[model samples]
Target: MTTAKTFSATSVQASNAATPYFSQPIIITSLEQNIWQQLEQEIVRSLQRLHCSRLQDSTLLLLHKIITNLVKTMHRHAFQRAIEDDLNLDISDKDSIFTELLQNELSMHGDRNIRKFCRANNFQITLIFPEEKDTLIQIEYPTSCNNSAYLDNKLAKAIGFILVKQTHDPSSSYSRAKVVKNTAIQSFRPEQAGYSQLLTQTEELDKAQAIFSQLNHGIVVFSSVGDILAISPAILTLLKLETALPSVHTFTNIIPDHFYNDVLWGLALESQEGLFENYRTRIRLPHNNNLSILFNISGYRHSDTTIHTIWQVVSLDHKATDTLAEGSILNEARVHNITRNYIPQLVEEKAREVVRLGGHTLPNEECQLAILFCDIAGFTTYVENNEQEESVIHTLNLILGKITKAVKKHGGIIDKFMGDCVMALFKEPHKSVLAALEIHKHSYDFNSLRMRASRDLLLLRIGIHWGKVIIGNVGAAGRMDWTTIGDVVNTASRLEKNCYPGAILVSEELYAMVTHAHATDISFSQPFYLKLKGKRNEQMARYVQTEDEPFLHDTVAHSARQHLKTD
Candidate 1:
């Protein structure tokens, strides 16, 4: 398994190319960093957007709730970026808002203006937006946080709370642009005078120079208008630029003109939250074949109106060449890139294949979602009694692998794994039911294989429910976990516990959703009302039986099954 490569903060020496890449992980602010001072000054001057939304109080309330929920979820390993309308925001701008709202926790009940709402005994708010330079004065709602990456459930929930109607139609949700791989770039057009002034500022220049020296990867900074500000020595080495860079390091001068559109696409940040693929291209070399580079582009506000677009460049993965052959090797900049399907819960290798064939990451959404929860029956007892530690682990992994396959086969995205349990999400209700049916049917065969091996046969319990769930990045500053969570998730988990061994139990809500779908070949038991754990009221549930297994059309077996379709 490839691990994240770690670079020294202030070193020129490159680590072994075979070693994994590890960028600095960002963390949420705690009390120690004097969090208040930083937060008090971090709110951007774009308070007008919230007030102008026509639902000022509700919007502020909604923003506060999201910021609160996200902060509470942030641990040491998760990172998040905040975006508004497709532009990335400095999600780290939590300090200013936190300082103001920490004590004023408001009651979000009625329709009232923000000023009045802020005056409420316990009202507080926070907002997340993409990084951009605007001269909007410092008039912000009291609550906000810097954010990025997955936590779809939170985002969807937040959006649902504020927008009575969606901004985009369902069909327009998926991106139409050629989704590039291993590359992410954001575009910006800063005012010319401000841009030139920023380039000349001693303080800005010093900050840029200081940051460039410590980075171990190639980075090329430019503007949407094609003006290049600075180029790192690492990138200089990759391009084999002799001597020093000329006075005008424009995009046309540095990047091949043909690839400029790719850079523009990278900057054209999609409004949806997703792990985009990096753009791939080759560069001319003085004495060697063109070397390919993986690029991820993003922009940050250099000043009030100047946007500094940063192009992060890394060499494509290759066999570990031992020696740096002058122009042939890009020493420190060598990196092993992973597919943008960064969510491990999702069967990414296949997802990447889907992406290659025009299927992209599901946009940040609050859509009707079907959530499936599956777990091994009696997993705890089995773990303790199993004598061979390695054997047990291996067997468990094999079982989980099979489950993962079954879920993917029937078009389900594995959300996450918890011990012996797995969570999968689907956009289609019928597909979700089909996936569950296939898994339950496949379980019998799977257990039989284990029995032949003289190992314990696994009994699976699965629960599925349908409801609206948010899908996006939910983590800290540098870490992200792409998954879904909401009442539907909780209901599914509850129903899973009520499941009998070797059976797929489903919630009443789920059963209702799929009942009308004549497309499935399954049987459902009558609603079984039971008092679920930690619940004040009893809920209705049912068991799903696979009367006949449906063939996964997307699978290779679909072609061979043409003859068997009549059965």
Candidate 2:
């Protein structure tokens, strides 16, 4: 295209009538892109020509020293008029983006001449108005793709400031044009800009949305302002929500409480600080509150140049879900109050706190509980022999702490720690039996290590019973203890008091219940009836034993670490 100073055209009527078109965002669909593009382009040309005409009078003798800015900026994608900015001289796409983008993007110095480099179009547009010395405007348009001379603005302006790319690949032959006109009142209909050369990028955005909807992956696009602009259909399907989405989308409305922190981190940056990458998180479903999915988070600049965060959810197999008891209140209660991840002592503490906060007493209720009472065999005599107080405390804490961990590991909660003794409760008889086996095995290892260290070897006497107990918080609200108080507790304590060292004794009722257990893992002595303290009739009980340690894995979950003392 010809530079403003050298280029000339025949005088033609330049109308300023704004009848059909004023500067407004046109609401045309992408299918009607041609008309939209023409209107916007004509508006930009008319406005810029008016600016250049103003400069012609203002810079009559000022020459090159009087450079004027391009006053009207428009963004056209293929054949679609996308957006407009009459104040800044930036092009809307990558082809003619401000050359300053190559430098530190934060440093915007505009002392240099206008320049553009289109890598794909294989051309450059340079507008240089040298100092008062040159006093001339020079524009060069070069296409090395073809062996033709680079067209100066004098010839390129006549050709409507457009160049066709000569590429072997048809798809790569996309054409681009930019016109900075200074006509002497000559205005004819301009050549076809990019109507047939390439489709408007709105079509590409439409295709992207279509593909996003069809894919199984969920997509959440957040605007730079953190409001959700669009969401893929898959997000609704994956989150188990209705296919129809709400009008006002936001992270606060969609993301669950557990995962809000992750999205907050993404939005905090807003593509200005840095690129946001995959931040894995759990996403709870809106419609099905019970279900949730693991999502991977990321962010990018959309076609509108707005930052958007995407949450790509990974659908897991049924086996990866929380627990088998889908809607059971009991199971959910256990998760909140008595999860195995905590110490056995802490589980009941948290459970009681939950109940106390509700402003209701834990009413004593009769329920079947697997009560386990265990004590260090000959612990009193061992203490008499070893009178070093600090040594005793250290040894007791080391061993007792390990035993307490085993109780929690087997899904039982510690009811009390009775100096060298432990009383625990379990919902299933099998778990109490497993805990006894674990304690028995641990005792053997403890004695072995003690023997090697020349210390008195210790033994474990454990008793397990399955029967009804009144379980609840005992004492007033200010000071209370969560415990079981019934005949079942006494029977279990008596069983432990009667048991011999290095053995586990179980009541006949516990043995009968465990007989139906899946692979009981415990062998029992022949059933025997014993007349015990306070028992009107004979009490049936068995001496429980395990031949092997049962080669169990260390942790129940994926995250537990192998502790030196507990493992």
Q: Give lDDT per model, in order.
A: 0.49, 0.53
lDDT of 2 by residue, 422-492 (tens): 89988779888988888877888888888898888787878888976665556665667656887889898
Q: After superposition, how far is residue 98 of candidate 1 from its true place, in Å?
A: 17
Among the numbered candidates, top TM-score falls to 1
> Which lDDT tens digits does candidate 1 get at residues 334-370?
4312433334745454345334323344223334678
- Model 2 spans with C-alpha error above 4 angstroms: 1-359, 518-520, 548-567
Q: By lDDT, who's the top model here?
A: 2
RMSDs, each prediction?
A: 22.2, 35.1
| Clash-forming residue pairs, model 2 | 1-153, 1-157, 2-153, 12-185
Off by over 4 Å in 1: 1-342, 345-364, 452-454, 547-567
RMSD in Å for candidate 2, one decimal?
35.1
TM-score of 1: 0.40
**Window of ten residues with lowest summed lDDT in model 1:** 174-183
